[model samples]
Target: MTSPASTSSKKSSPLESSHRRVPTACTRCRKRRTKCSGTNPCRNCIQNASECIFQVEDIRKVTVLESFITSLKRRITELEEKVGKKQKGENGTQMPSQANPTEIKDGVRAPDTKQDAKCDDTRGLAKRDSTKFDIHLEASTSEAVYSAIFAIFSQSPSDPPSPVRSCSTDESLYNDVLLLVPSPGLAQLFASVTFHRFSDYVNNVFQFLNCGYLSLEPLALINQVASFCEFEGKWRYFAPDAFMAKCCMIVALGELYEPAYCVSPRNVRLEPPLVDKVPPGFAYFKQAVALLPAFIIEEDELGTQSVLVVEALTLAAIYLRVINKNIASSNFSLQALQMTINMNLHVAPLETSQEDRRLFWAAYSLNRTISLRVGQPLLLSAEEIATPMPSVNQAPSQKQELYKSEIHPCYIQLAIISEDICKTIYRRKCTTQANGVSSLPRFTLSMLNILSKLVRWADALPQNLKLDACLTSQGSYESHTELDRNRRFIYSLHANYCHCIFITTVPLLINLVQEQKQKGSKGSLDNPNVWKIIHMNFEACSISLRLYESLYRGKLITTYGFMDHDYLFSIGLGFIMGQLFDFSAYPVDISKYEFLKSLGKVFNILTNLLHNGNRIAHYKCMQLLDLIRLNPDIERESTKMAPVMVPAAVPVAIPPPVTVPIPHPNDFFLPFDDLLFAEPTVGMINDFYSTMSVDYYNLTEDDFVLFSDTFDMHV
Candidate 1:
């Protein structure tokens, strides 16, 4: 394939070709090119898309018979000269007839030396006579096959270097390319690759996709699963796709099983913060999540398998309850959990039988509630060490072996899946966007998936629970120090999450800035990356939302488990936007109190919106943020201020569902355009991004290039 760089290179100008009049393909071939069973797709064309042309479009300098004879005779004479020269050099014998008169000179095959070995390297250097060419030939073409060939040739790294050039500086070209990348909206890319040439690939993969229950796979499904078990402190550079991988594995493996809850001393939360720890067996879980999607996804990225949301959440809850040291607060996860349930219920009731997917979600919600309700850590004490289990060698006794609930083959399957997801989510995250919405879920899910695996090990144990023979007499969890284990676990989890943020989020976000800046109004989904980033952005938000809901549902405040600092901060994003509505666009003029109050409102809404009725309100909250215009001084502020966080109370608490609806945030773009607020109740969020920092949001025309991405302005 052509490298993106090469495909953008300058093409030779028509003036550069001074000699070739209609330089083109062999006449014989052109006349019957379609019949020629040559090139990669020629045969395919003959049997299928029959118009696949084999002959090159442009006429060549030489005719078929003349070109062939010229080439062959030159080669023969060149060899004969070589043989004659060798004979003379070795035996002092001289060949007659001017050494076959085929030798070359001046690095060019002299017409007289066309058959000589001396001219071998220059055999094809002769100039062509183009003035005598015919002009009556037809202009035939190959569309599809050439398109594929163009893609390959354009992308191939081996191509000779050429000057780089944009097809046009008119900006429309850029907008067109930009439109081809992101996935912030509809599935524009669904037309190619797995769909081959249509959207059918997705239509074929999901029972729901074809039925219209969902369109364009939520893509966040995996992260939703990972969030429930999110134990990693905070994410670093994780990609949004990591979340999908993690969630998919859970649904594929543990969707229908009863979850086990056993806490491990070690756990990882979103990618990691700034710590390091000993690696655990469950780290493999992240790896698997990263890989599994390739098997099921038809697009370049994985498609949503919504079932993952239910299955993963259930397992993550069970694990958080059983594995890892206690956290400073359950508020982070609790708040998200409560909302997760409310959202699910609001979307569709949870009363359906176990056969229904909602049943799984309800079960998951139930499990988390039980885990968070606990006042202390299940596996770690206050000082932070692995808590001792009463069972043997971290194993069951001979009599306990007979019990099957935890040890069932299903549990083992879940464990295996968890291990894979943990590894997969983290591994691929290294390549995704960073700091942007696309990076969020990856950070969230890797941590959750890892925690889920460790926790499951305990739940899967036999109820009789006796130590394995090795640890029965000497091995014991009682010996480990809580503080030491906590430190180790935190460090490892921290390191990974940090990696996610730096490597994944930042790049993706930066790209988003460029993307949104370059977007045209003609079609949003046309750019796959845009759509991906947009979805990633919300999905990341969703992960945070779900965690807070879990904390709320479980009511596990003051417990050592997942912290809720992010929830407070995330909910605060809404606050900033709400504040923006009341304050001036000037950085200095924006009200600090308004900002604080808005943030608080966001948190309040987030906590309550988890209820069925408030989802529309929650949607409004997101839309409000999307409507926020940056303060003019935004660029002057340190990037540290970008996240705009408020210190969260430890053990964050959840509030009741919201019954009141919030007003839409003000817009800077054509404020009077009704379409902008037509769906004030709830609508997909749209954000303005820029590679270079800018205070403007909605529609300001400070950057001409930004508008150049304009479909409205460009044809």
Candidate 2:
């Protein structure tokens, strides 16, 4: 109060004080276009008896110059640090102490103002890190655009709610659903059959094919089955539906492998023929499917029981596939995948149990297999997968250790590469170019990469698991049980490997065929890339055909399933197409005899399957036979070729030939009968052969028609 000038300078102006006090406006006041008291509950809001809300201002307008300056400052600091480090290294001395030490603020180290000022000296020489700068700019631009759009469309309290109804149901409905569990006597019999015949095979061999079995503990599953068999009255338990479903699915799968269910003329005669009787496992599978809905509805409350539901669905899918119900199998596999994802199994945390990891990979492997087989899009991509491969060291037994250490990891890796193949080569965008010509160079590169991985996968196999080792040492096992397990495992592994090679190289074969057709000659194999493709396809077809022969002689072929049949058919078709188009134009001299013999063996296998009640096999066999008939010279050449040598170690026990009564020509075999036996018109055959060069997977049904019509027309 000594002087008026001093007092004026010390006190703030009225406008400045008012600006500080009114930092933001209340929503109620802003909506009315009136002045805000700035407090949370403003005077107007209090007077009107309405709640007041103040939204935080998150969007800050950044000028180009301001952003540039900030980037320049950051660049300068980075440059100074780099220079300091380099100078210290050159001088063989430590860096000088910073006058202003760094301090930690909000868990980030912040340099003092003095240290920042020192960085400004070399600002002109400092270069911007374009990679980081671009990323920052992109992030900022996206955020600003998003903020503006969000502000424009922000919801208000007065807005009405969405009209869509909830899907939630009463909890009582889930509990009230009837479960058709098997009686104790039947359950005991089925469980015994499963445990004795199927369970051991699954634990030792089949689990490698589809890893979902790894999630199940054999002893625990046994205990659960026993408990269920004894329990009475509605089967009350935690997640009872899922538990019963799992139990039923296990028994259903077991039924497929039982001796009575094995597809032979004897078995078919003892039971109803394929056309009349439902598949062996249908009763239990029906029960499993019925219980699945209740478990799915109450998935949230099930907790760890959710894994059992996935396992049940997976087993159901496998059983369905075994019976050749592919569409339904695909649906079940996809549902399991969806459930796995919902449970966060795909991105399993580090602390997740081994069982969970195994379950995740099983779902992943099965989905990938189905997608590749059906030409469907993948439900999950590799980028989204975080679960690690099942660990070998974690295996409780030496047998499990062998599989986990040697087979499981390799299989998972192959599945991943398979996914890559689907994405790179089969995806619609990658398959075609703007001008409509196939992208040959791009596809060729992808094929090479995938083949290299497949080669590595083969190379990484343990000594015992290798194809050559398993084949040569067939008599080396101590017992028939071990021999059976090893035979199935090695055969499956080798088959998958050959199939991958075929898939990788087949596109090139198609291209070569198309080019030869267009040019009207076996166009030059002078190109190394073309020759490489031919060699690969030749090797794959030869190995797979030979494997089929081995399986046939050993009586190890799955006569009922579509898998072996499909594999044999595809490889046979490849062989025929190669012979017809002269795929081995350059290398025909070396493999011609072997190739002819393999082709001849296919006929024998197909004939055997036909007698075993496999209609698909019958259809495939007839098609190949027709192709041979059309080309008599090829058959003459095959007849002259030496028969393939059957390994003496594997006893070729030819079962007593049972006469299979022929069904009426008009009789159908469920879904495939109509598709397989449909008469092909001239127009259909022309259209098929024209587009055959464009797609491979889509050609099976049409190819059947083409072959049948060609045979009929010729006869």
Candidate 3:
């Protein structure tokens, strides 16, 4: 049975032979289904192929188009090489050590594996080196190759890692080997991959890419594939915006193949399997293409928005693949992503109603902008997408408007994903890391730091310099406010990235717990139940972290969630919580988790505070119960929970025992007073509420009842 990826590739049927695409149409299609006449097929079948029994539409024109694009690229590379050669000859002076471009790029091994001999001529490209380049940092498209790589570099704060030492590779080589080399980078990236280094074969092919010492036919075809599939991105006819989208897709895929991690830092790798996990001490390619538009001087406003579409499509493609069940599914998704890459959506090339068009652009822009990273471009109906952007600055004109609905939800979603990815990796690294003895995977502190910074790029969105205000038509700007939680998030992320590089545990766990508690304050973070959200985020974070750790450090001990809560227990949450309360007075989840296997440390901490005796801290813990009760908003509304920027001196005493009425037993009390706060056991603590004796206006104990007895519990 064909694997999904292979099936998708095979399912790509031959296109009907238009006079133009004859060279590519299969002989069977050319001969009208009954089968081909001979060699290439004849005019009868060629013309009648449409009339043939085979389905006219079964063919996936998109893949064929992709093939066309790849062809063109190969052609271009040839031209570039020829041009370079001529330039070299024109100089007439022999230079001793001019490096081949492919040779200069290290980590890329020379392909030595045996590929089908016919694959070379049929594909118009050979698989010499077999190593792939991760064109991350732009919209990445994984087309016309063995596999693609996506690389993301971020700066983290949780685990500040040490500085990275760059691993340089050879530059001046290009060969047909690229065709067969397939996902060479994955060797450095610890993950399940089909591509193993072809080694000896990678050597000579790269020279072919440097100068047109080879044929141009393959290159021409490659370019067409890129254009139609919106993969390679050339011909410049698909509109600049479409091209940009394609570029973005390329970068996204590059990042994907960047590399994966071990489940832990200490687990032994699967012997030979380790060989493909990455070259020794490999360094990430520093230059990026996504920043290209920003690099352009004097970029126009509309163009900037257009470019974002590309970013959306590109980022979407890469992220989607990470979670996708089938790698080949990306090819289909790629076409959908490519559609919006065109600027025609904005320009309204077709004849349509003004209102309709306006509304369409509005919604499209919104969905695309948010999706720019995730790649699942909103399948908004053209009508909704066309919704006029909220009056480009609150204009009086008859422009339709959309509410400010997209950002908050989108941000939340993104934050959630980023957080989860972070935790997944963290747990992974801890468990898989070698005892400073095992061979490490390729991805190291440097890459994790880069990933942190990339995620923080979200925070950079609101920075004063340039906001992607596609939605803000016309709003007067107020003086920028001081740092918000978003800013704090980015800062914290920076610290986490750094910590990861250095591989320190205590600080990492401490920060996540502390920071999340801060987020859980009044309502904002707590509204959504910040603790739960943190759990989910860390889950994802741990997965991604583990994936990378294995590649850079060692394999994980287990594939499930990366780290056991025992790590949490062993590190001693009580010690961390104590420090957090001391320094910030915030509340974290001291609550027991069902998923957590062991409950040793938490009980110990609770007992320690009780035994060792810190009254003030104990009072605060009791106070936290009261605080939780006072602000039922703790769970109802997330906004209220943002860490208090500054301590506001409110009346600390619980309203001097004031109370009015208690309709339901769930009714809240006037003020909180310490109740029977015995050892925290399985039963719910009644001390959550306070008792206060106020004047006549305030009620008595008979008037008040416990809210918990009747009120529903917060999830």
- For candidate 3, the lDDT comes to 0.27
Q: Judged by lDDT, which candidate is best?
A: 2
Expressed as tens digits, the lDDT of each residue in 1-715 for candidate 3 is: 7799557545655552223243344545554443332334444455565332322356564535634754674565466566666768999643222212221111111111122222222322323321121111111111100011000111111111111111000001111212323332322322221112111111111111111011112233234434444223222232334333333333333332222321222232222122122221111111112333342333345454543443333333323322221122233234333343344444454454443333333334333322322223234333223323222223323221111122222232333333333333222231112332111111222223333443344344343211212113223222222222122222222222322222222222233333334355422222112232233233323322222222212121122111121122222222322223222333555333211111122222222222222211122222222223233233122123222221222233322111211011011211111121121211211111111001211323332222111111100
Residue 130 deviation, candidate 1, in Å? Answer: 39
- TM-score of candidate 3 on Cα atoms, chains taken together: 0.21
The C-alpha stretches of model 2 lying farther than 4 A from their native spots are 1-214, 227-240, 260-273, 394-405, 428-439, 476-482, 583-588, 626-715
Q: Give the per-residue lDDT digits (tens) of candidate 1, residues 61-153.
A: 763773466467567666766877888899898765443232321111212323222222322344421111001101000111111112222
Alpha-carbon lDDT of model 1? 0.28
Please state the error at residue 251 of candidate 1 in Å: 35
Kindly indicate the candidate among 1 and 2 with the higher lDDT. Answer: 2
- Give the per-residue Cα lDDT of candidate 3 at 594: 19
